[model samples]
Target chain A: EPEVTQTPSHQVTQMGQEVILRCVPISNHLYFYWYRQILGQKVEFLVSFYNNEISEKSEIFDDQFSVERPDGSNFTLKIRSTKLEDSAMYFCASSELLAGSGELFFGEGSRLTVL
Target chain B: GQQVMQIPQYQHVQEGEDFTTYCNSSTTLSNIQWYKQRPGGHPVFLIQLVKSGEVKKQKRLTFQFGEAKKNSSLHITATQTTDVGTYFCAGRVSSSNTGKLIFGQGTTLQVKP
Candidate 1:
């Protein structure tokens, strides 16, 4: 089956550095999302994208964070200035239908470590 | 703001034992979805419960949604070592179609052979 794929399974960067996490959501899926999970913490929503624009975002998705679908297949999340608290496993997900339909498929995740 | 909490942060059981995890949401949910993450792996979709008092089973695993749509549970009967993973219950409000998920803290299960 097709699945979401993320690049750079592990990323290490110094504080204040810019970092871009890339993902390729499953083809044919219209809805894409980003979620983060701190070590031993709940998964937190970051942002949701549809129709080439952000549909919703969480408070955690602040000015420093941005997402874009550069093309038909690649979805990217960029942090302008990374903070230590930004270290976590970032997951990319996609759903064939609506979010409430509940069949979101998640990527393996990119482990970001900001020092 | 909405929050989803799960009970028993960790569970260790012998192979063939039964296991269960409970999830509660601070607010009403239009639907609830379950995911399982194996050691050092990503979360994989398991099932979704949409109706109040809904119950669905997949072999040894059973899932139920609360009558008030504020709680959910995952029960695994005769669990094997492969069942050792973290289970998360994610809640979603139908009012929002952005596909964002409010996930529970998750219950990590360890099954010993």
Candidate 2:
């Protein structure tokens, strides 16, 4: 089955450094999203992207966080300055534009670690 | 934004016993999705329930959506050791079509052989 792929299975960065996580969604999917799961916590929605623009975002997705679909296949999330609380498993997901079916296909996830 | 709540934060059962997890949404939902995450693994889609009072069954698992579309349940029959994992119920609001999933805290199941 075709699946979403992400780079850097794990990353370690300093508290004030910039970090970018990359993802390549399923070729035919038009809606993309970014979610995070803190250790032993619930999965939280960060942002959703469609038509090259963000459709919705949560409070956690503040000015320091940004997402881009620089190309047809690549979707990236960048954090200007990483905070200790920002360390979590960041997941990239995509869904076909089918109505009434809100199934999400998620990637393996990128574990971000800030020190 | 709608929130989903799952009951029994954790469950422990024998291999031959049955297991069930309940999910309740604060508001009406357009659809409810179920995902399973193994230890140290990412979430994998199990099924999605749309429409009021819908019931769907897999080989040994059954899912139900409440009549009000605000609650759902997942039941496993004769659970096996392989059924050990965390199950999450995610809901999508009726007003949104952007495919954003609001996930619940999840129910972790432990099966003893």
Candidate 3:
């Protein structure tokens, strides 16, 4: 089956450094999302993207965070100046229908470690 | 803010035993979804419930949505060692169209052979 793919399975960065995680959603999917999970914690929604713009975002998605569909197939999340608390597994997901209206296919996730 | 809560943070069962996980939402939900994540793996979609008091089954697994649409449950009959994983329930509030899902902490199940 077609699946969403994420780059950089693991990343380690110093606090205050910038980091970018990339994802290639399923070719036919129109809605893209970014979610994060702290160790042993619930999955947290960060942002949702559609039509080349952000459809919605959560409080956790603050000024430090941004998402972009830089190309036809690439969706990227950039964190400016990472903090220790930013360490988590970041997941990229996509769906053919509207966000919650349909099932989401998630990538294996990019584990970010901030020191 | 809408929230989903799951009971029994962890469960340990012997092979062939039954297992069930319950999920409750702080607000009525438009829909609820279930996912399973194996150790060190990503969450995989298991199923979605969209109607009140709906029930669905897949092989040895069964799922139910409460009449009020605010709660749900997943039950597995005659569990096997392959059932080891964390089950999560995610809910979407009826009032929002943002498509954001509030996920529960999840119930981690360990099936022993």
Candidate 4:
């Protein structure tokens, strides 16, 4: 089956440094999303992107976070300055239809470690 | 903000025993989805429930949505050792147009052989 693919299976960055996580969603999917999970915690929604722009974002998605669809296939999330609390597993997901209408396919996730 | 809560943070049972996980939402949901994640793995979609009082079954697993659309459950019969994983319930609020899902803390199941 076609699946979402992410780069940098694991990234270790220092505090106050910029970090970028990249994802290539399924070929035909329209909606894309970014979610994060702290160790042993529930999955938390960060932002949703459609039509090359962010459709909705949660409070956790603050000024330091930004998402971009640089090309037809690449979706990227950038953090301006990483903090210790930003350490978590970030997952990239995509769906063929609207959020409530179809199931999401998630990538294996990129583990970010900030020190 | 929407919240999804799951009960019995952890469950341990014998291979032949049954297992069930319950999920409750703070707000009525337009739809609810279940996902399973093995240790150190990403969340994989299992099933989705849309209508109130809806029931769906897959082989040894049964899923139900409450009549009020605020609660749901997953039941597995004669669980096997392969059933060990964390099950999560995610809900989309009826009032929101975005596809943001509020996920529960999840129920971690450990089946002993």
Candidate 5:
């Protein structure tokens, strides 16, 4: 079965440095999303993207965070300056446009560790 | 935004015993989805429940959506060691523009052989 895939399974960056997490959602999926889970915490929604534009975002998705669908297959989340609290497992998910059945498939996730 | 709550943060069951997890949402949901994440792994889609009071079964697993569309349950019969993982219930909020998922805290299941 086709699945969502993310690059850089694990990343380590300096506290003030920038980091970009990349994801390639299923080819036919139309809606994409980014979620994060802090250690021992619930999964939090960060942002959702559709039609190459942002649909919704949470408070955690502040100015420092940005998402782009630069190409048909690539969805990226960039953090301008990483903070220690921003270190977590970032997951990328996608769903088909089918109404009433918006099942999302998630990637293995990129573990971001900022020191 | 709607929030999903799962009961029993953790569950320990014998290999051949039955296991069930319950999920409740603060508001009505368009649909409820179930996911599983193994230790040190990513979340994998298990099933999605739509329609009020709908019940679906897949092999040894059974899923139910509450009549009010605000709750769901996943039951696994004859649990095996492979069933040890964290189960999450995600609710789909119907917005005019887009649909987003609100995930529950999840219930970690430990199956002892």
Candidate 6:
């Protein structure tokens, strides 16, 4: 089965530095999403991207966060400035269809560590 | 705001025992989806419930959506060692089609042999 794939399985960055987490969603999928899970915390939605624009975002996805589909296959989440609290496992997910009820396939996740 | 809460943060049962996890949302959901993530792995899609009072089964696993579309349940019958994982229930709001899901805290199941 085709699955979402994320790059840099683990990332470590300095506190004020920028980090970009990359993901290649299923080739045919149209919608993409980014979610984060703090250690031992529930996974939290960050943003959703479709048609090359952000569909929705949560408070956690503030000024520092931005998502881009720079190419046909790559979906990336960029954080302008990392903080200690920004450390977590970031997951990229995609669905075969665009509906809210469609099944989402998630990547193994990129563990971001900020120090 | 969408809030999904799953009961029994942790469950430990002997092999062959039945295990169930409940998910409740503060608002009506357009759909409810279940996912399983083994320790050290990512969440994997299991099944989705779209209609109110809908029920679907996959082998030993069964899922049900509440009559009001605000709650759901996943039951695993005759659990085994392979059933050990964290089960998460995610909800999509009725009017949102952005594919953004609000996930519950999750229920971790430990099946002892």
Measured by lDDT, the strongest candidate is: 4
What DockQ results for candidate 3? 0.83
Per-prediction CA RMSD (Å): 0.9, 1.2, 0.7, 0.6, 1.4, 0.9
The TM-score of the first chain in every model comes to: 0.98, 0.96, 0.98, 0.99, 0.96, 0.97
Q: What fraction of the reference interface contacts is present in each model, in order?
A: 0.80, 0.59, 0.78, 0.78, 0.56, 0.81
The numbered model that scores best in DockQ is 4
| lDDT (10s digit) by residue, model 2, range A1-115 | 9999998899999999999999999999989999999987788999999999999898899999999999789999999999999999999999886323757888999999999
List each candidate's DockQ score: 0.81, 0.64, 0.83, 0.86, 0.60, 0.79
Pairs that collide, model 6? none
For residues A54-92, what per-residue lDDT tens digits would candidate 4 score against the true structure? 999999999999999987999999999999999999999
Candidate 2 — what's its lDDT? 0.92
**Model 5 Cα lDDT, one tens digit per residue, A32-103:** 999999976678889989889999898899999999999789999999999999999999999896323767
lDDT of 5 at A58: 88
Per-residue lDDT of model 6, residues A11-80, tens digit only: 9999999999999999999999999999867889999988999999999999999999997999999999
Candidate 2 wrong stretches, greater than 4 Å: A98-100
Interface root mean square deviation of every model, in Å? Answer: 1.0, 2.0, 0.9, 0.7, 2.0, 1.3
Model 3, B1-113: lDDT tens digits are 77899998999999999999999998999999999999999999999999999999999999999999999999999999999999999998998776888899999999999
lDDT of 6: 0.93
DockQ of 4: 0.86
Candidate 6, residue B86: the lDDT equals: 94
lDDT score for residue B83 of model 4: 92
| Runs with alpha carbons beyond 4 Å of true place in candidate 3 | none
lDDT of residue B28 for candidate 5: 88
